[model samples]
Every structure is written in structure tokens, then in C-alpha cells.
Target: MTKSQPYTQADLAKLGNVLIYLVDRLGPISKTKALKLIYLVQEVSVKTYGLPFFNMPFLVWRLGPVAEDVFVDLSAEEPVLLANYIQRQEEDCKTFIHASQPFSDDEFSDNEMEILALVAKTYGSLSAERLVEVIHRPHSLWYQTARENGVLDYLEQGRMTTTNFEIDFGRLLDDMPERKRMYTGQLDYLEQSRALKV
Candidate 1:
């Protein structure tokens, strides 16, 4: 059966999301599987990559001629904040961007804390608003996804302000019933910190 040639926005989003998750858990990334994911998506040559697009799309697949995988440089060029990612998304109308800088510190709370930690080592520090932007992906499906994903219930003034992140953390620690397995996982992260020298 013949397969598709072009990659859809969702496919692109999927790759972007997966890469984002990988960056959160790991740090920095290699260009090795960049081509593999695209080829599997396009089914172009049973090894298709992707068309070169501007905005650096976080991914690239040089199908016909170059025959290579290309990834965008999500470098911090400058300190990135919530405004940075949000403004860029508003300008580009897409979430294909990646982080080019990283900073690790326990400067956040709630999902913001870990989310911040995850991106810290890759995207640097993000403002609560910027963190909200990442949490607001279309696939995230607000309201439902917010709670399911342990993102909502963390908002303050109906917005995910930094204060809300701390509030969420405090509330989670105080009210165990509302906590999810992810909450337990975060606790483990904190526990690990206690094991440290500093």
C-alpha cells in the first residue's frame, strides 16, 4: 500500500512533544533518531525524513537530495522566559520550537517546580506564564487535560501564576486526597534531594 509523502501538523506536533518529553527527562539531545522518526512518519522512502521548513520546526528530514536529518538549534540566544515562548508561538502560530538553553534550580513549585526543573536543564528558566504556555498545548485539552495531567488545580486567579505553583505544591502536601501518582513521583524527587550533601 502506498503511504503518505507529507507530514501533518499533528505528526509534527507528536515529534515535538516526544522530543520535549525526552529533553525533560534527559538533557541535550543527539541528531541520530531525528531522521528515523520522520521517515517512519512520512513513509516516503520507508526511510523518509521531512521537508525543510523555516522557523526551524524542531525537526527536519531532507528526503530526496540531501538525505539527512536536521534539528533546529533551540539555543537560548538570550535568557528565555514565558513571554519568549508565548510571543514566539503567537508569531509562528505553532509550538514546534525547542529550548536552546538550560538552568537547573528549585525555583518553582506545583507542577511548575518539576516542569521548570525538566525544562531548566534544557530551556533555562521560564516565567510562570511561559510554563503555562507549554502546559497549554492543543493536545493538552484544558479543563480535562489540566486535571488529568496534574496541571490545572494549580492555577491562581484562574491563571498559572508562580504563586499558584507554590500554592499547588503546598496544597498537594497538605491534602493527600487530591494527589495523583505523579504527585508521589514528585515527592520521590524531593526525597532524592534530601539525600544530597547540599
Candidate 2:
């Protein structure tokens, strides 16, 4: 395996296209819902293909799994990464995202497209709040990570906090031994390559 490289502008563009595709399929959706849907896409891809769909890191946040960079970009007054691909509108005190252009599948494989469609069809109709509930269910990555980091207790006590914890995607492999082995080997190769580079 090659050393893991930093996410590039091209990668961001692809991510923006993914957002556009999801919005096109699901119609205008709130930022929260969009983030959850993206997380679901990653989850499905990792389980099915033994690899992540994208390079974005999903952190365990109070609302569930959040891709921090995407969250920041979406909330920016003048978005950089997705400026040409999407637009956000404010209505009824909610921020809803819309696709500003047509989606292109040139950057994604057939399996990736299938994962995106699957996540949209399965979770598209659910509200952001409902998606949060789903992600917070027992044994879910966000739930497990939050619990391990004591963030769950903080949240349960009605305490306002700024705790964001890294979620271990490796945990997604717990039930699939073959996939787990492959995933771990991939990780090992990436780490070894990184060390050699240094």
C-alpha cells in the first residue's frame, strides 16, 4: 500500500460533488442531515468494501458523527471548498443546503455510487433528529466512542460541552474477520510507508 497522502483540492472537489449528488437525490436537506448521511455512506462503504468511501474523518460529537472540515466549510460565511457546488439557504431558522450544479460521477467508482444511493434511499426520508438517534444507538461507532471518552455521560447530564473525540473506524470491522484483517493490513502498510517517508 502507498503512504496515505494529505487530502488535496481535487479530493475536496470530489467531496463537494458527493454533497451535490446527495442533495440532488434527497432534495434540500439541513446541514445536520447531510453530515449524517455522509457518515452513513462511509459506514456502508467500509462494511461492504473493507475501505472508507472518502478520506474525511468523522469525529464523535454531541450530535453524533461529524466530519469537522465539512461542517466548518458548510458553516463558513463564504465557503471555499464547496462554493461552486452547493448553496446554503436560511429558512424558518434552519439552514438547508442545495445543489448549485449537476453532480458528476467521474471521480467515483460504481461501488461508491451504489453506496451513496443506498444511504440516500435508506436514510433520506429521516429527519436530522432521527438520524442522530440512529447514530447514537448502542454499539454504533459514535455511541461507542462517546461512551469510551466519557462524552456520553457529559451529554446525559445536560452539561454543555465542547468535547469532540476521534472515532476509530477500525471498530467497524469487529464482526467481519476477513475485512478486519485486510483493513488492518492496509493500515499497517500506510503507517510503515509514512515512517519510511519521514
Candidate 3:
């Protein structure tokens, strides 16, 4: 969600584990959809826990937010972390990533596992088009980052640091309603935009 440090191998492994876990739950999914799921998990985790789940750097791409490192690895001939567990395929002319084997939840902490499960349950079923809409919501990290940087990579780790946000019970409770409205309004706007484009 925010500009974080480049991921280490272990981080990629943990992220790969989350990806595989989601693939198992949702079936083979498009790469774009997979990236959105990863972004959403990080976004929610950052807001709720004050620390991002994977510490992966994300950029504001034309499609929305993308973890370029993860994308490159998955597209590699032998993916760094997902080599044995994932396979890339083309179906109906669309690229998709499918799990080659079942995933184990051993690498993830209880909190990480909880967030992964929650994200998968809430968003795994959505189409990629819908995900882009949800992610571009007003006040979302993607929206803010894109507005500030245009299409450039998010390189402001200082601003994204947990220290920048003071998370308190009262603050969270107060912000929840506004966040809900932002999410709803963004979806409505996206639908209208899509209609206009069509």
C-alpha cells in the first residue's frame, strides 16, 4: 500500500504463500486480480495494524497498484518463491496464474494468516475490473499515491511509515464510517465511469 523496502526472499516466500493460499480458495485467478488481492491485504493491514503485512513496495501503475517485484518473479521462468507451487497459463486469451500444488500456512504468522484469510474471503470473488474500482477509491492509498506522483513508482517510504499515522481505538472507530463512505462512493463513481467508457 505504501512505499516500503524492497522485499527480501523470505518476504517473497511469505507473499507467495499468501498468493497460493488465495489461489486455492478462489481458484485460478488473473495476475491483475492476484496483485489487487495482495494490495488490499497490505492496505487493510497497514491501516489496522500500523505496519504493512509484507513490507512490499507498490507502485501506481495504469491498472492500479502493483508489486513489480512480485510480478516479475511470478513471470520468471522459475519464479523465486512460487516456482514449485504456481503455474502460468493462458485461457480464453487472458493470462492467469494457477496453483500447481496446495499451499501450507506454516510460513505466515497468525496475524498475517488472519489478514490473508479475511482479504480472500472479502475480495477473492470479485472480478479484476471491480478490484481496480475498489482500489481507486477516494482516500485509498492508491488514490493518494497516484494523485501525488502520477504514474511513477511510490518512493515515499517516509510518508508511508507507521509513525506517520497514530492508530488509536477512538481514532479507528471514528474513521471507520468515513472509510465506508469513501469505499461506497468510489464504487459508484467507478460504475459511472465504466458506463461512460462503454
Number of the top lDDT candidate: 2
Model 1 Cα shift for residue 91 (angstroms) = 28
For each candidate in turn, the TM-score is: 0.21, 0.87, 0.69
Ranking by lDDT: 2, 3, 1
Q: Which has the higher lDDT value, candidate number 1 or candidate number 2?
A: 2
Q: What overall lDDT goes with each candidate model?
A: 0.30, 0.79, 0.65
By the lDDT metric, which is better: model 1 or model 3? 3
| TM-score leader | 2
| Model 2 alpha-carbon drift over 4 Å, by segment | 1-6, 185-198
Cα misplacement distance, residue 187 of candidate 2 (Å): 5.3
RMSD of each: 19.5, 3.6, 13.2
Q: For residues 62-142, what per-residue lDDT tens digits would candidate 1 score against the true structure? A: 111111213222222332222222111212332333433243322322443333233335333433234335434443223
Off by over 4 Å in 3: 1-7, 76-81, 150-198
Q: After superposition, how far is residue 104 of candidate 3 from its true place, in Å?
A: 1.6
